[model samples]
Target: MDTSRLLRTTTTVIAAAGLLLTGCTTGGSGKLQTAASSAQPSPDPTALRPYYEQKLTWRECGVPGFQCSTMKAPLDYANPGSGQDVDIAVSRRVATGPGKKLGSLVVNPGGPGGSGIGYLQAYAGIGYPAPVRARYDMVSFDPRGVQRSSPVECLTGPEMDKYTQVDQTPDDAAERAELVAAFKEFAAGCRARSERVLPHVSTVDAARDMDLLRGVLGDEKLNYVGASYGTFLGATYADLFPGRVGRLVLDGAMDPARPSLDLNRDQTAGFDTAFTSFAKDCAKQPDCPLGNGSPEEVGERLKDFFRKLDAQPVASGDPARPLGEALATTGVIAALYDESAWPQLREALRSAMNGDGAGLLALADSYYERGADGKYANLMFANAAVNCLDQPPAFSGPDAVDSALPSFEKASPVFGAGLAWAALNCAYWPVKATGTAKELVAKGAPPIVVVGTTRDPATPYRWAQALAGQLDSGTLLTYDGDGHTAYGRGSDCIDSAINRYLLEGKPPQDGTKC
Candidate 1:
């Protein structure tokens, strides 16, 4: 159970791959228009000139058409002369064009820990709508402390395997203590291994890094598509450099004004909403594991199953790692990210109930990005680093979580207790938060499109509504559907609207619903 406010975008990729076997703020006018000329000089301090002017020598790397490069940014933006710098890993696929080429369209798939370069090379660069790709260069970068960009390392694979197995929904003081200790151990590992990069991995810093990338890419304005936590990153960029904003799309948006606890609670409710949807769907399926019942009954049964696991673990295929409540819950949450994964989740649940925990364990491993070799990706490590630095802990201690458990449970009867406890992980972070909840108006930016799916489990639809209302020029586009994000998920309505905006600079009408 990861404690981050937003799930990594890669979760969808992982979930889909597993199933393959089985299954922001307004300003200005409400209407989007062509961005101001890129020829206009930036208002950034002169101290950053070198970073802004640095050239990227891209060379072929991963896939056929994609190129990878390293970008340099100051480790500490306030002290560019500190001698310490971070190299941001970047990738791009130049426009395959017949039409006039638009500027680069930077994308972030939102892990704060997620590998933007990996996402670019894997999907966005090659899989995006070709018409849009024909006009704009598809670009992305690993944010500082992510992947090749001075990644934050925490536990070893064995250590992480043990950490994930720690019981998230503690039943007593001893269990609670164990959970806290696990969080402390994780944080200590990060401090010990990644101290140099840990303190500098805040979203604000990443947003500034985007500006540097923009200048290096020779774009006067930053055109972008940011999903999940990437939405927050995009919103931060717009807030910091509204003058440079161009055709920005924040899908599966986060409300910047929500405090950490509220965000957690809301997200808890979101998962419950998604689970209810899943339960309803499962009830209709012949092989539904929980059996036919109301969504509420289904949730209760699932909780009962978790309690059973809490008492006695199940055998997973890996002898070293048995399936427990934590991993099983994570597995369920991972499947909830995509409705298409429902069938997979159904089968996994059935298998888990039948004593074979491999299916659920596999889902959990995917969520954690654990390779078959048992090596875990840096996604979770960077996730905690950035999330802890971005906002204060949702709860200060176990007692706080206990007190708030009722609210969380009220929000989500099934996922609440575990998620509430999971939220406590940030309380032990080695670095204090450098940011806080606040509205991002991006006052001078042109119209930016904010898309929200009605049943997004990780990012609630209300957040999109709040963010759109907060932005002075925000235009809200709604997909009355399920899943984590709306775009690129088979919704022609959502895709066309975003494509039109990217290619023609005309945002969907404000409050448009598809």
Candidate 2:
């Protein structure tokens, strides 16, 4: 849960590469200027538009149940009158059932950069609850620098291998220097590879893109559901186009009013909280590896074990592969995303401590999406690019991170400053941020539901409260449990409440804790 926040002054906010954790860029007035481009930027398909506007066709593409279409909007919206066009890839699954159909519903699964098109095709278009699915034409697309539309790529497979293996929690000067190199190389790769598209991928730009998509789809109002970073995207759309909103739902929401360092620090604390919960449960189980002890004791033992591994690396049963900091940290990050995986995490740790690295490596592989053949997806690369583009990393240099260690360690004695410094990956982003933090008031928009899971590690629950508070028409629905999101993680009460809202536009009672 990234908290996904930025600090604001009056109505303006300092923009960086997305959410400033604690230092999301405060006290700056208009450092990053908003684009003054026209609001009607749609002539992008052709350099010479007015002359050829009459020639372009908008026929629907055949995709079984979906209605696919192509749209040309400005690659840069500020100059909508410009002839340079950016084609948008769009798809919609129209509702078909005995009951009357609702207009449309857009789904976003937050990475500030995840592929909405892929999410739609894989999950929302079909995996959404049947009743809700039958009433709305589900829609999705790849945002500017995302997949399918026009992706922002950075590293090759071999280069990426070195990048993911960088040690975050450096023990010696050599290790620390290695970490620095990794960060610099990653930033350099983006600047070198994605320079053309990096500067234009800000959240504001994406939100405006949404507004244009809303128009081309023939909808006067937009209905949507966003989670994690998606919450920030939805909130931004509401801020920029308050009047065009309809039935918006922001779950696993991010706070839109914090800086980068604080955001990451809070998440550090959150993971600590989750670890504490996991520890308590583990100690009560018979298979507990750290032995039967108090939760705090179990945590202390785990921390000591990690320290031991840091000093002397463990053999992970592979000749060229070793279980190092990156893999270990990722294993923990993955566990934090899903509560259902906690017991598995405990077992993984137990096995790892006994010279068996397979279990821990498996968890790490899932987080990194590593394959048996050693092939890796573009998830981390895209994540770093989108995140770095959204906001500057929380810290700028290794010295700064070193100085901030005490506080980060206090935040999580186990994770410590490594997680804090990991937040600094975007501090030196090649492109500048074009968007800033702002409370989306959606003053006259229909009631939007903001859902929160009590112990969600990736998107902290408190953020949902913050987002709900900012939106004038937002109501809170609490899922008193753990995990990144509550939707399909299996709580009848949570699912039913959200389903009712999407299917019937019936918001659950405010402050209703499930």
> In terms of TM-score, how similar is model 2 to the real structure?
0.85
Q: Per-residue lDDT for 1-514 in model 2, tens only?
A: 1112211110010001111011111121111112122222333333323322321233344335655555554556556555555555566677867578787788777775565665665567777888878888888766677654555677776676667667778777998788777777877887788776676676777776776666555567789988777888888788766778878888888887766777777777777777777778888888988777976788788877777767665777765566765676667666767666778888888778887777777777655546677765444556666666565567778888888899989988877666876876776677665544456676777888998888777677888999899988989999988767777667889889988888777999999999
- Summarize candidate 1's per-residue lDDT along 1-514 as a digit string, tens digits: 6644755563434732110000001111111112221212233365666676566776777368877778777888767746798888887889999799998999988866877877777678878899999999999888899878888999999999899999998888899899999999999999999999898898888888888788778788889999999999999889877888989999999998999999989999999999999999999999999989999999999999998888988999998888889999999998898998899999999999989999999888888888899998788999899889888889999989989999999999999999999899899998888788889898978999999999999999999999999887999999999989888989999999999999999999999999
Q: How do all models score by TM-score? A: 0.94, 0.85
Q: Total clashes, candidate 2?
A: 27
Top-scoring candidate (lDDT)? 1
Stretches of candidate 2 off by over 4 Å are: 1-71, 81-87, 371-373
lDDT of the structure predicted as candidate 2 = 0.67
**Worst ten in a row by lDDT for model 1:** 18-27
